[model samples]
Target: MKNLKQLELLEDVLENSSIILPITINGKRRSEIEVAKDTSKNEIIALAKEATSKWLEEKSIIKEIYVPNKLVNLVVK
Candidate 1:
């Protein structure tokens, strides 16, 4: 198990190992998504968007995908 902020090679990330990544809206923590350690950055972003869509305002936009910190930030009107 890897702690948050610990950097590791993708090859060493196993499917069975997962983490709860933080999802933020306008720099505020909003939701969380459990994803495999091997999940790609794009996939993590998609999951964050889906998980937070309900509370997302109209015309909301994803602003950042910071994998190192396991955080997905969104911009909302």
Candidate 2:
């Protein structure tokens, strides 16, 4: 299984009010989606997972990362 460090990092970033969603196309990152600070972690993760799954179905890929205050960084890929 892939190591999803973002699960742990989400806890830290949730308090900081920002979440990073990196969208990749054909193994290359194309853009990033940022969640506002007021967004709930569960909501963010659910949305990200849905988006990632949809991207995978479309032959693309996406990974969600949560960086909190630049102190800790976690990635889903």
Candidate 3:
């Protein structure tokens, strides 16, 4: 049986755990990135770019960021 202390610890861990957000490029789902729950828009975008950097071309650039949808659009030449 789980004790109250164990439950509280589990809850704390979950509260601070990172979340996986889907990354979209050109309106298409390309990959997913993990970030903290309290991560800001800019931080999320940076993480997404880093996660998808290999797939992105040298000329690729972030054109839009939809934080609510956890999506980032990249324009690749």
Best by TM-score: 1
Instruction: Note the Cα lDDT for every prediction shown.
Output: 0.75, 0.50, 0.76
Tell me the lDDT of candidate 1.
0.75
Which regions of candidate 1 are displaced past 4 Å? 1-16
What's the lDDT of the predicted structure labeled candidate 2? 0.50
- By TM-score, highest first, what's the ranking? 1, 3, 2
TM-score of each: 0.68, 0.33, 0.67
Ten contiguous residues with the weakest lDDT in model 2: 68-77
Quote model 3's TM-score.
Answer: 0.67
Off by over 4 Å in 2: 1-20, 23-34, 55-65, 68-77
Give the total clashing residue pairs for model 3: 0
* lDDT (Cα) of model 3: 0.76
For model 1, give the RMSD to the true fold. Answer: 7.6
By lDDT, rank the candidates, best first: 3, 1, 2
